[model samples]
Structure formats: C-alpha cells, structure tokens
Target chain A: MMREIDADKVAETISGLLQEGCYRLSDDVIHALKLAHEREESPPARHVLGKLLENAEVAARDKVPLCQDTGMAVVFLELGQDVHIVGGDLYKAVQEGTRRATTQGYLRKSVVDRPFSARINTEDNTPAVVHTTIVPGEKLKITALSKGFGSENMSKIAMLPPAKGRSGVIDFVVACVDEAGANPCPPVIVGVGIGGTVEKCMLLAKEALLRRVGDPHPDAEIAELESEILKRINDLGIGAMGYGGRITALAVHVEVFPTHIASLPVAVNLQCHSVRHREAVL
Target chain B: MKNNMPIARAITLPLSDEVLKTLHTGDELLLTGVMYVGRDAAHKRMIETLEAGEALPVDLKGQVIYFMGPTPARPGKAVGSAGPTSSYRMDTYSPRLIAAGLKGMIGKGMRSGVVKKSMKKYKAVYLGAIGGAGALISRSIKKVDVVAYEDLGTEALRRIEVRDFPVTVVNDIYGGDLYQEGRSQYRIADLRR
Candidate 1:
C-alpha cells in the first residue's frame, strides 16, 4: 500500500524550516561555541566566542537572523519508496516554498540569474539545490542547510591516490584548515568525505555535516580515525578567529562510501562556528 | 565585568593614534556618528576619479568605511544583514583610501603585507566584526543613506550613522595583526607527536 504525502504539508514544512533555520542558531552550534569559549586560551578568542554567543541569543530573542547572509537554502530529502507526493510538481512546490521563505522569512535573496554579467538578485531565493533520495518505508526526512558564502568560497575538493591512505587524508585535511586559517572562522566543523567518487565525495562531505556534533562514526576504525583528526585539528593552534588557542575545531566528521580501487577522492567542506542547519521529518 | 561606556564617545570623535591606542583585539564598539560604505566597484571609481585630478565623491578624512555588499533593507529598516566581507579583496584599494585620509576600515580575514605596511605608514586601523554576526551588527546602524553609486544596489557607497557598532581590532597603526599572531599560537609542529 502506497502512503499519501500532502504537497501543502511539504511546502509548509519547507517554509517553516527555512525561517527557523535562518533566524535562530541551533543548540549544537551554540553549545560548540560555548565549549570553544571555555577552552580558548587567548583572551581575544574568548572575547570573540562571547560575542558570538550573545549575538545568537539576541538574534533568537528578536526573531531576526543571526547573520545577514541568510544564505542559499539547500534541501536534502530522504523519501520513502512507499510514500507518494500528491497534488503538484514537487520541484515547483519546493521553489515556491523557497520564494515564500525568502520574502516572508526575510532571508536575504542571494540567488542571481547568472554567475557573471546579468548578476541580479532573483528577489526570492528560489530553485533550492534539492537533493532527493529514495529509501524503504513511509517516512520522509528533510534536512535544510542554509550555507553562508564566506565559508563556502573556501571549500576545496581534491582527488588523491590510494597510496595516500589514512595519514595522507589527515595531512590534507589539516593543511586545508591551516591555509584557510581565520577566513572560515576557527573552531570550525570539518566535514570530510573519503573514498567516494569526485562528485559523490563532495556530497558525502556535506552530508557528513548533518551528523550531530561530537557524534562518533559507527565503524570502530573510522571512529578512531575521526578522533585522531579531531585532536590534530584542534592542535592546529588556529584558535577562535585564528586568535591562537587550545581549540581550533569543534568537531571532525568523516563519511565514507566505497570507491573505485584506484581512487581516494577527498573533499573538505568547512563550516564556520555559525553552522546553521536544521532537520524535520514529515 | 562591563563598563558603562557611552556610545557617543566612540562614534563621532576624530580617530587619532591616541584614540586608537585604547582599543585592542575583541573589544565591543558601538560606533555612532559617521562612516563610509564601499566595496570593489565604488573603490575603482574613487581611484579613477582621484587619478583624474577630481575630488572624491565623499571626503575620506576622519572616517571609517565598511567593506560590505548588503542585502536590501526591509520597509522601515535602515540596512539588512550588513556585516564585513573579506578584507583581503580590498587590500590594494585600502592604501589609496588611507593615503586619501581614510582613518579606519572594517572587515574580516588577514590582510596582505602591502595592506599592513600601508596601515603602519598611514596611521590607520582595520577592525573585524564577527564574520556572521550581520544581524546583530546592523542593530547599531541607526540610519543609512546611499551617498554615491545608487545603481550599484547593495554595493553602493553609503554614509551610515551607527550607534555602538561592535568590532575587534585586527590591524592597528602600530602594525599589529591579530589574525597572524593568533594562528601561530595554535599551529602544531609535529602531527605525529
């Protein structure tokens, strides 16, 4: 028996999530900032953390956005094969929802028609970068990540040889952070994708960010590696805003998929302390 | 412990070496009075206008210019999420702006050698607001009026009067750079160890 999925419900969910995610900083992110504050040795870094925390609380209380860059809304959907979307074009519905979210939600309209030349705001943040996947059963999972461009511009992808192994992965990831320094904001959450194809690797890296902060990988070997990377990343001395401190990264999340025998594609997606993401099931 | 520092004292006064000495990396500032707003496009125009032996659209003396391309403000709002962009992009134009009597800049990230050298030579300073704290920062700006390049939309040059805007001192007239100084402290020598 196929389950019926209401399109209006989906649209409402999208609008609600977009507004909530844009305006309020998440608990995990705020907790990470607080932890960074306690661990930060440098006075400047500590002050920066305090300001970020205060800003988050004030923005939440005022029902205003935490950052001015409300960012392009990215939707990752996990649909149950047994569920059917009713009454409309799913793509159009999502776009309309995004539009409403932009105007009513007061999110910044960051989307432009083209990368160059006719660079004009689309007015409404439409045509969200929607990633849909089908799974068994009747439940639908939707995750919205409102990404700011400051950190997005600094994201990098590299394809490495199989020989680089785990050590090489750690080195590459740390080096990427070192080069980025304070640009992406320190105490960053590093999303690492290992062993997938080039494009898949990037997707996996970003998906890794959806994981709860400080959550370890299920695989013992992978979990151990995650711990190692987290330790080394924090040791990078690129404390809060590169002020130098005990903590540079709040967490290192690694997600892996089987890849071609000869390829070890790695992607590093850096999210600043203000990692604005939220999830809802409908 | 916080002090009840008045916002007026910080914003309207002419910035000098003596005034700058009191600030440090990570202090909250609520700048009021006046500041200029310009980005890549207006910067080029300013330089070209200056090279043509013409006066700049706005006087650069005793002022701060934020490097930003903000979203349009709401109906009654003065500005949208108006936070600083990366400072490195404006490194080239900054020296010229400083030479033209610019006293301060607000942005994020580390500046290049040339920008730092110019700040030292010109007795200017660069301040950093929380990169993503745009909403909170905008609350300080009481009024915003586009003084030049209205066609540039969000990137136009504006004369904004703020009340107690917040920022951290990144590069000062004494040639101090908090970004570099902060990074070296966390850099690990041997990953294996």
Candidate 2:
C-alpha cells in the first residue's frame, strides 16, 4: 500500500524539526554533559560545563539559537519504499523546508554560493544537503542536524594501508583529537568510522553521531574500541571548552562496515558540545 | 565546592590602557559596554577598503572586535543568539587591525604566532567566549545595530551594547596563554604506551 504524504506537510515537519533542534537540545546529549560535568577534575573545565548547562536552559526557554554559526542544514531522509509524494517534488520540498526554517524561525542563513570566487550568501539558507535512503516501512523519517562548522572544520579522514591495522586506527583517531585540541570545542563527541570506502567511511562517521552520546555500539569489539578511544582522548586533557581536564570526550561512537580485503579506510567526525540533531516520523 | 575559584572580574569597555595590563590568561571576565562585531567576510572588506586608501567604515582605536555573527533578533529583542565564531580564520587580518590601535578581540580557539606577536607588540588581548553557548551568551547582549555592510546579512559589521558578557582571557599582552597552560596542567601522562 502506498502511503501518500503531502509535500507541504513534509516541508512543515522539517521546518518544525529544525527550529526545535536549534532551540532545545536533545535529552541524551544533555544527560551526557551532566555526566561529563561530574567526571571532570579541572576547576576551569567544571566551570565551563556548568555554563554550558545553563546555556542549554537559556536556549530552550528563550527560543534563541544554541549557536550563532547555526550551521549548514544537513537533512537525512528515510523514505519508505511504498510512499508516494503528492503536490511537490521531494528535494524541492526539503529546500522549501530549510528556507522556511531560516526565515520563519529567524535562524542564521549560513549557506553561500560560488566558493572559488564571489562567495554570495544564499540568504534563504536553501538547498539543504538531503541524504535519502529507502526503507521497508510505510512511514518516512526526517532528521535535521545543525552542523556547526567549528567542529566540522576539524574533521579528518584517512585511507590507511591494511597493514597499519588496529593500532593505526586507534592512533589516527587519538591524534586527530589531540591536534584538534582547543579548536573543535573540546569535551567533544568523537565519531569514528572504520573499514569502508573513503566516502562511505566518512558518511558512517557522521551517522555514528546520531547515536545517543556514549551509547555503546552493538558489537562487543566495537564497543570495547569506543571505550578505549574515549579513555585515551580524556588523557589528552583537552577538557570542556578546551580548558583542559579529565573528560575531553563525552563519548566515542564507532561504526564499522566490511570492506575489500586490501582496503582499510577511516574517518573521524567531531561534534562540539552543541551537538544539535532532531528528527520526526510522518 | 566553588570556594576556590576566583570570582569573575567585571569590566566596562572601551578598555583603557591600565585595564589592558591587569588581565591575565585564565582570568574570567564579564564585559559591559560597547564592542564592534565582525568575522571573515567583514574583516576582508575592511582590509580591502584600507588597501584601496579609502576611509574605513568604523573606528578601531581603543575598541574591541568580536568574531561573531548573530541569528536574527526575535520580536522586541536587539539580536538573537550572538556568540563567538573561531578566531583563527581572522588571524590573517588581525595584526593589521591590532596595529591600528584595536584593544581586544573576543572569540574561541587558539590564534596564530603572528597574531600573538602582534598582540604582544600592540598591547591587545584575546578573550574567548564559551563555544556552543550562544543562547547563554546572548542574554548579555542588550542591543545591536548594523553599522556597516548591511548587504552582508549576518556577517555585516555591527555595533553592540552588552552587559555582563562572559569571556575568559585566552591570550594576554604579558605572554600568558590559557589554552597552552590549561592543557599542560591537566594532561595525564600517556597511559597508552
């Protein structure tokens, strides 16, 4: 049975999700931060964490953005195979949704055109980066991530030789965090993707961020890897707001996929404490 | 539990020469009074205007520049969610501005060696706003108005009035750097070897 969804409704749903996502942070991240506050030893680190908690409260109550960067709108769509859209094209509707979110919600329009020359602002913040995957269900799921560039700018990817093996992956991930230092807003959530093609691995890293902060991966080995990486990251002492402390990472999320025998690719995506993402089903 | 921590010193801006010398990296501050806001795009334009031998849009002497661009103001509010962006992107343009008598900068992230040298030479300090705490920071911003480059939208240069704006000194004229000091103090000996 085809589930006919009105495109206008899709736009409205997306707009609503983006607004709520920017204003109120999800419960999981907030909970993780609370845990992080207790774990930190440095006074400055603890102080910064307290301020972040307060900021989260202020953002929700006032309906103001959590960050001024407001970030590029990265939309993820899980479309049911049996769904049919009426009245508007899917991608166009997504763009319309972002436009409405920017203008109506008073969100910052951060998109621009022409990178090489004449970087003109796309004032409407249109053309959300829509990633669609067809699924078995008759219902569609929409997610919006307000991807702040401060952390996005620090993300790194590498195509490692298979011989470099497990230690190399661990080393690479750890070093990335160390080098990112105070830049990507420390006490960050580290997302790791292993064993796939380069682009696929990068995508997986971003997908890993959707997991609740510090939730273990289903695979026991991967879960162990996540814990080990988290331990080492905190040892770097790039604490809350990079003021240095015992909890540099609130969590480490690792996702892995099978790959060709000769290839081992890895990607790291860092999510600053802002960590804004929201989703709705329709 | 909070007894050991130093209280944040309140500052009224248009920072005077005497005030500049007293600030140290890691000292918490709550800023009041006015500052100008700019970022990558606005800084580039100001440098361009100056390079062309044209008059600059706003005065720099004894002024602070915040590396920020805010969300649109809500109903009856001056601005929305004003927070600092990364400062490194402004590194290329900062020395020139500092040389022009700018007193301070507010933003997050570490700055460049050149920018640090310029700060030492020009007697300027770098302050860091809490990254990702825009809504909390916005509460302190009482008013905002675009003073130049309105076409740039959020990146437009603006003059703002603030009360108890929160910041920590990351770089000071006396060669203190909080990021460096903070990291070393807490870094545990490598447990992985």
- Could you list the iRMS of every candidate? 4.1, 1.8
Q: Please list, in the order the candidates appear, how each scores on TM-score for chain B only.
A: 0.89, 0.96
> Which CAPRI category fits model 2?
medium
Best by lDDT: 2
Report the Cα lDDT for candidate 2. 0.90
Model 2, runs deviating above 4 Å: B1-3
Which candidate ranks first by TM-score, i.e. highest? 2
DockQ of 2: 0.71
TM-score, first chain, each model: 0.96, 0.98
Q: In model 1 chain A, where is the ten-residue run with the lowest total lDDT?
A: A114-123
Tens-place lDDT digits, model 1, residues B22-119:
76644456566778888767787788888899999889887889887776676788877777777777887888888888889988877889988888
**Tens digits of lDDT, candidate 2, B48-162:** 9888988789998999999999999999988898888989999999999999899999998889999999999989999999988888888899989899999999999999999
- For A1-282, candidate 2 gives per-residue lDDT tens digits of 898999999999989888888998889888988998887778888998988889899999989998887888899999999999999999999989999999999999898999678989999887788889999978899988878899999999999889998889999999999998888987799999997888889999999988888789999999999998898888887788877688889999999998888888989999998887888999
lDDT of 1 at A34: 84
Q: A113, model 2: CA deviation in Å?
A: 0.8
